[model samples]
Target chain A: MIGCYDFCGHYEWTFEWLSQLGGHTLVRAYWDEAVHQDSQTHASKLIREKGFEGMKEYWGPTLADEGAVYERTVTDDVFRIDMHECPSKGFLLRNGLEQYRDYCDHCMGWIGPLMKDAGFVIDHEHNHCGQCWWEIRRKDDATPASAAGELSGASDVRLRPGWQSPHTDHYERSTDPDDKTVVS
Target chain B: MASSIPASLPYADTKPAGHADFYFAVNATFRFILRHHGEGALRKYWQDIGQSYYQPVSKRWSELGFAGVAEYWRAFFAVEPGAEVEVSEAQDEVRLEVKTCPAIRHLREHGREVVPNFCQHCFFVNEAIAEPAGMTVRVCGGNGSCTQRFMKATADLPPQNLEDIATAS
Candidate 1:
């Protein structure tokens, strides 16, 4: 049976497989339809109904269950996450499994659409080395992403050494995975 | 959680058990494929993954034989939370009596709509994996409980009937 014990490995592999079968359009549809709409309906519902509080309710136990090393900072205006060690990405890295061009985009692929539907936007970046940060806010707020250590203080992922990478992908106040700009 | 993974598993992770929520994605993936591409494509996806993504496990089974197949399942289920399976190896074959499939249990608990042909994945994927190892597998029952038998290709086992596998809700 295709057990969930190595779900990340196969999940990443499936992305490349689907991409091969139908290209990036198919992949993006899979994330939005399968992941965002179908798989993560609970997250979509939570955020859609409660907004910022929903993110907290959804990610807190979920991340802990996945064994992520991360910190969440929430205020009335925005919900921020400093992902020091992303469990899913860490699993792929440790196992040397890289099938898709960018595994990290999957988060935004699903979450970005979810946030857009929930009247929010996200500012996020991932280094492909299992380190990333996210700041989500109301779309109309128009506030830019906070500087390093400004929101989460010392717990900010940017302040850590090796956080920057030539492959680092950054997104401003946006809700589309394709909106990312690669930073050296 | 076990500090060390069993040697039979091809990949390793810091956490012993996987996040159960991923089962939702698996089911969703099937739904996506079935809706857009159709069932044949979905089954082909399963076969491809079994042949490609699980190439290492198949290679190990080829080298180690039936003993390797038994070891792989035992180790595979160990880290799967909520799985209750008994893998017994005899001279001719290895049998797996699954009382509670972890994916089915988790998906059911969360009220996810399971794909009707979900159980067929076991047969298609396992058969592909066993093919290169000079073995064959037959799966019976499903939704929540099932029995899988793995034996050498030379064994006079009948072809698996799709009706034998129960449809998942």
Candidate 2:
């Protein structure tokens, strides 16, 4: 019945299906329209209304419910998350289900638009594994991503062993998924 | 929250039940497909997933017959938080009596708008999965609860009427 018990499986599969039907553009739209605007409207509403505090209220319980292993660091200027173990990506990895090219991009695909609407920008990086980090700030802050471990201290995902993959997708102060720089 | 684990489920995760928020994405995906593409495309997507993504399930059902269907549903529903389902097996068929559908209940409780054709997904998807196993499914009732029967192709059951399924709000 398309149950959520295995939502990650079908969700990833649907990415490729949508892309097959209408290339990358359609996939992007699905994330922005279906995910960010529709499915994740709760997050949008919260973050938009409460700003940094909303990210706290939204991600705290949500990540705990999804059984993610992560740490959140917040200050007057920024909200940061160090994702040590991302349950969604870990599910696909454990199940050996890879339909979309970069499943990690979906995070930015939806969150980027959400942040832009909230008048914020994001500094993010992911190894395509279950590990990633995010730093969200006001669009006018003009501060670059904190030096490794500078914001999160020992909890920084980039400082962990095996943090380096063959390629790491990096997003600077940006609010578009397409605005990414691939690094090796 | 599940008491037992069935060996037939293809993918296994560390958590007992999945986060219910995922149902939102499922519903959103259906709406997106229905809005951008036609109904035919949405049906194709469901059938395609059942046939392709669920290949292992069909293969196991082919090996274990009715027993596999019963076992798989038991495990599947177990992880679905708030699901109330019973799976029973007999000589020729397996029956799933869903007292409360987790997806529908969760979506409704949260006040999300569900697509009217939501319940039909079970039919198309399960039919695709059963076809490869030389089995068939007949579903009646929906939106919140339903009865699904998995029987052999030779069972001669009447074709399912779309009207039997209730429209989701």
Candidate 3:
């Protein structure tokens, strides 16, 4: 039985397996089709129906259930999250499991398409070390990502020491995982 | 996390139980593979994962035999929320009587559409894992509950019939 107890380990392994079988295109399709459309349809439905409030409703309990150490800042115009220790990534790191080239891209891979469908865009960055920040806003809002300590005050992930790494990947007002730029 | 996790488990996590929502991904992954690649590819994927990703478990089973299989399943099910299983070990075999499968229960409770061949994964994956340990497994019944028998390969044992495995809704 493929139990969920170690789902992250196998999930990361499956990414590399898919990539090896059909390259990056298959992996991207898996995220969009399998993850965003099929697995996370509930998330899609919530965000589609409730917008920013939906983001809060969806991530709040979900992150807590997954045992993530994170903070959320929500306003009428935007929804932001500062992830200190992402449970999924932290699981892989603690277990020394790394099969995919960039495991963090999976967040954008599924969430990007969901946000695109929800009429919003995202400004996000994740260091390979289980720390990241996200700012989500309406597509027409044109607001850039909040600076460190701007939206969430001192709770911003960027304010943490060693927040920036050579492997940090950044996205600016984008809804596609491929749009990231290496910060180093 | 390491201190809390049992030695039998190949992987460890900070949380005691996994996020049950991940069952959605497992189901979705099967549907995606079957839709795009076909059944053979899906089976191959399962076999490959059992052989490669679970290599450590297989090695442990080889080293410890039936005791390893019993310990592994007991520890594995302990952290799987909503699972109800009984694992028993004998001189020649390790038997698992699954009263409620966690993945199936979670998926069904949330009204997710399960893949029809979902239960076949247990056989394919377990077989792959057992092969290297000089053992074999037979899974009977499925969908929600099943019986799995792991024992040394013997000529008297009959080949598993796919029909014995129930199709998941």
Candidate 4:
């Protein structure tokens, strides 16, 4: 059987497989339909019912379970995560497994839709090398993404050395994964 | 450095056990593939994964034979949380009696709708892995529990009957 022990490995490979089968559109649909709707419905329900609190509830145990090194900074208006070490990306990096073009987009691919359904928007960025930050707020809040250390002080991921890479992708108040602005 | 890794498993992770929530994605992938590409395509996906992504495993089994099959399954299921399985090895074959399939049980507990043909993945994937290794596998029973036998290619085993496998709910 295809066990989940190496799920991230196969999951990343599957992205390339689906992309080859029906191109980028199929990959996007897989994330929205299979990932966001069918697979991660529990996350959808939690975030929808509880809003920002649900995100906390969801990511707290999830990141911990997946053995992520990160910090969460939350205020009344927004929920933010500073991922110093993302477990999934770390797994692929450690194992030298890269089949798809951009595996990180998958996060926004699913979570973006989930946030939109929950009446919120996201400000996010990730370096291809497994470090990223996410700031989520209610759609009507209109607060901009915070500057480095504005929310989490020393815990800010963007302030880390080499945080900005030549290939960082940024999403500003966006809910669609493809809405990223490339940074060189 | 290479010797530190488990001989049976091709990949290694920092964690001892896997995040069980991934089973949900596995189920969803099956549903999506079947819906879009149909059964033949779905089977091709499984076979492809077994041949490609699991190439390392096939190589190991080719070198180690029946002993490798037993060792691999034992270690494979060990990290799959909620799995209740026994891998018994004899002179000629190895058998896996899956008492509680982790994916099926997890999907069921979460009230997820399972694809009816989900059980067939094991056969197609394992067959692909075994064929290239000069071995063969037969899978019977399924849904939540099943039996899988791995033996030499020349062993006079009958062809697997899909009807013997239980359809997933």
Q: In TM-score terms, which candidate is top?
A: 3
DockQ of each: 0.72, 0.65, 0.87, 0.72
Clashing pairs in model 3, backbone N/Cα/C closer than 3 A? none
Over B99-131, each residue of candidate 3 has an lDDT whose tens digit, in order, gives 999999999999999999999999999999999
Residue B68 CA displacement from its true place in model 3, Å: 0.4
Please report the candidate that would top DockQ against the real structure.
3
- Candidate 4 ranges beyond 4 A from true positions: B1-5
Give a tens-digit lDDT track for model 4, residues B47-114: 99999999999999999898889989988998899999999999989999999999999989989898
Q: Where's the lowest-lDDT run of ten residues in candidate 4 chain A?
A: A158-167
Q: Alpha carbon lDDT of residue B107, candidate 3? A: 95
TM-score per candidate:
0.98, 0.97, 0.99, 0.97
lDDT of 1 by residue, B11-100 (tens): 888887878898999999999999999999999999999999999999999999999999999999998889999999999999999999
Measured by TM-score, how close is model 1 to the native structure? 0.98
lDDT of 1 by residue, A66-153 (tens): 8999999999999999999898899898888998999999999999999999999999999999999999999999899999999999
lDDT of 2 by residue, A31-126 (tens): 999999999999999999999999999999999988899999999999999999998899899889999999999999999999999999999999
- Per-residue C-alpha lDDT of model 2 across residues B1-169, encoded as one tens digit per residue: 2223566788877777889999999999999999999899999999999999999999999998998888889889988999999899999789999999999999999999998999999999999999999999989999999999999987556887989988988
Q: What is model 2's C-alpha RMSD?
A: 1.8
Candidate 2 chain B: worst-modelled 10 consecutive residues by lDDT: B1-10
User: What TM-score does candidate 2 get on C-alpha atoms?
Assistant: 0.97
